[model samples]
Target: MNIISENKSKKIEIEENKSKILDIKKEIEEKKIKIEDKKKELSKVKDMAKGEKEKMEEYKELKKQFKKIENEIYSTIAPLKREMRKLEKIVTDKKLKKQIQEYIEFPVKTFLNDSDLNVFRESIPNIEKIEKNPRKREKILRLIEYVLDGNLEDKKKEYMAYKEKVDSFVITSREENKEGIIKRKIDNLQSEIIKSEEKIKNLETKNDLLQKEILKSEEDIIEILEKDLDVKVQE
Candidate 1:
C-alpha cells in the first residue's frame, strides 16, 4: 500500500510542475504582446516627431526668405523715403502737399501718368467755369499747375522742340520743382517695401507657432522613449 501511494504522489508532483511551466509560458506571451504594442506606439511617436522636425526646418527656411525680402525692401525704399521728406519741405501748395502725401502712401507706377494728364486737360474747361469764384478758381488753378508740372517732366524725354516748349510752361511757371517728379517713383517703391514688411511679419508669426509645435513633439517623443521603451533620451 505504501509503494502504491509513493507512485501516485510522484505522478501528481509531475503534473503540478507541468502546469506551472504552461502558466509561465502564457505570461511570457502576454508580456511579448505588450512589448510589441509599445514598439508600435513608439514608432508612431517617432514618425510624429520626424514630421514636426521637418516642419521646423521648413519654417526656418521660410523665415530666412522673409527676412531677406524685408531687408531688400528696406534698402530699396529707405533712400526714397528720405527723398520724399526732402521734397515735402519745399512744396507749399496744399493741393500739391496732398498729392505728395498720396504718392508716398499709394506708390503705384501708373498713377499720375499720361491718361491722368489727359483727364486733367479735359477738365480744364470745367475749371474755367469756377474761375469766377476766387477761392475755387485758385484751388483749381493750383491743381492744374501741379498736374501740368508733372506731365511736363514726364513728356520731356518723349516729346521734342515745340511740344517741349509748350509743356515746359507748366513746370517753369511753378519755379521748376524736379523733386516732385522723383517723389512719384519713390512712392511706388515704398508701397512694395510696405507689402514685403507685412509678409515678413506674417511669416514670423507662423514660424513661432511651428517652433512651439516642434518643441511639443520632441517632449512627447522623449516621454514615450522613457516611459514605454524604458530608455533615456540623450537630448
Candidate 2:
C-alpha cells in the first residue's frame, strides 16, 4: 500500500476509537444519573419505613398505657365492690338495696383515698348493726339527722318525755296493780311504739337519699376516669 493510503487508514482507526470512547463516557454518565435517582428513591422509602415504624411503636405504647389504666381501675375498685356486695346482703329493705346499688355503680376513684374508704367501710357495718338491733336504732337516727342536715333537738325532747313517763308508770304499777290504769298504760306504750317505728322509717328514707347523693358524686368521678383516662371499671 502507498503512504497516503496508510495515513488515511490510521486517521480512520483513531476516529473510530474516539467514537467508542464517547459512547462509553455517555453510558457511564447515564448509569451515574440512574444510580443517583435510585439513591433518592431508596432514601424516600427508608424515610417512609422509619415513619411507619415510629407510628407502630407509638400505637403499641398507647395500648400498653391504656391496659395499665384498666388494671389500675380494677385494682382500685374491686375491694369497694366486695364491701358493697356484703352490705347489700346484710340490708334487706328495698330502699336500702336501691341505695346500695347506687353505691356499687359509683366511680372507682371516690373511695380510693384512705379517709373516704375508712368512712365507707365503717358506715356499712354500722348501718348493718343498727338495722339488726333495736338498741342501736338511736345511733342510726343520729346518723340520719346528720345526713339530712337537720336539727333534732325537739324530737329528742319528745323522746325523753315519753321515756320518763313510761318509767314513772312502770315504777307506780309495780307498787299498785290497778286494772284500768294498767290497760291505759299498755295503750300508751303501743302508741309510743308506733310513733317510734314511723320515726325510724322517716330517718331511713332520709339516709337512703343522702347515700344516693354520695354515690352519684362518685359516679361522676368514675365517668371522667373512664372517658378521659381510658380506664375500664367493672360495673
Candidate 3:
C-alpha cells in the first residue's frame, strides 16, 4: 500500500511539472509577439522620421527656388517700373505735350514700366485700414486735401521767394563785379599818379643842380672881367 501511494504521488508531480512547462512556453510565445509588435512600431516611427526629413528638404528647395524667382523678378522689373512712373508723370504734367505724344506711341510699355506699382501695393494696407473705418477715411481725405492745398499755395510762394532771391543774387554779383573793376581802375590811376609824382621829384632835383652850376659860371665870368680891368689900369 505504501509503494502504490508513492507511485501515484510521483505521477501527479510529473503532470504538474508538465503543465507549468506548457504555461511557461505560452507566456514566452506571447512575450515574443509583443516584442515583434514593438519592432514594427519602431520601424514605422523610423519611416515617418525619414518622410518628414524628406519633406523638410523639399520645402527648403522650394523656398530657395521661390527666392531666386523673386530676385529675378525684382532685378528685371525695377528699372522698367521706374520708366513707367516717369512716363506717368510726363502724362500728368500739362506742359509735357511732346512727352505725352512720345509715350502714347508705347502705351503698353508705359503701363508696365511703372515702378510705382510696388509703392501702390504697399499702400494697399493703409487704404484698406482707412476704408474699414468711414469716419477715419473722411478725416484722412479731408486732411490730405487741406495739406495738399496748403502745400500748393506754399509752393507758389516759395518759388516766387526763391526767384526773388536768385534775382537779387545775380544783381548783387553784377554790382560786385562792377565795384571790383572800378576799384582796379582806381588802383591803376593811383599807381600812375605816384609814378608822375616820382618823375616830378626827379625833375626838381635836376633843375636845382642846373641853377647852381649857372650861378657859379656867372661869378667866374665877373672875376675874369675884374682881373682884365686891373691889368689894363697898370699898363
lDDT of candidate 1 over 62-124, digit per residue (tens): 555544544443343333333344445555667655655554564332232334543344335
Work out the TM-score per prediction.
0.34, 0.33, 0.35
Order of all candidates by lDDT, from best down to worst? 2, 1, 3
What are the Cα lDDT values of the candidates?
Answer: 0.49, 0.50, 0.47
Candidate 3 clash pair list: 81-113, 81-114, 81-115, 84-113
Candidate 2, 197: how far from true, in Å? Answer: 99
Best by lDDT: 2
How do the residues 1-235 of candidate 3 rate in per-residue lDDT, one tens digit apiece? 3434544554555555555555545555555565556556556555655665565565556555544544443443343333334344433345343433333454333323433333233223344343457776565445334433443344334434544555554555466454345455545545554554555556455545545554554555556657667988999
Give lDDT: candidate 2, residue 150.
27
TM-score of 2: 0.33
Instruction: Give the poorly placed runs of model 2, Cα more than 4 Å off.
Output: 77-235
Better of 2 and 3 by TM-score: 3
Runs of candidate 1 exceeding 4 Å displacement:
1-13, 84-235
How much is the lDDT of residue 172 in candidate 2? 51
Task: Tell me the lDDT of model 3 at 181.
Answer: 54
| Backbone atom clashes (below 3 Å) for every candidate | 2, 0, 4
Candidate 1 yields a Cα-based lDDT of 0.49
**Each candidate's root-mean-square deviation in Å?**
25.9, 44.3, 60.7
Q: Which residue runs of candidate 3 sit more than 4 Å off their true CA positions?
A: 1-146, 149-159, 168-180
Question: Of 2 and 3, which scores higher on lDDT?
Answer: 2
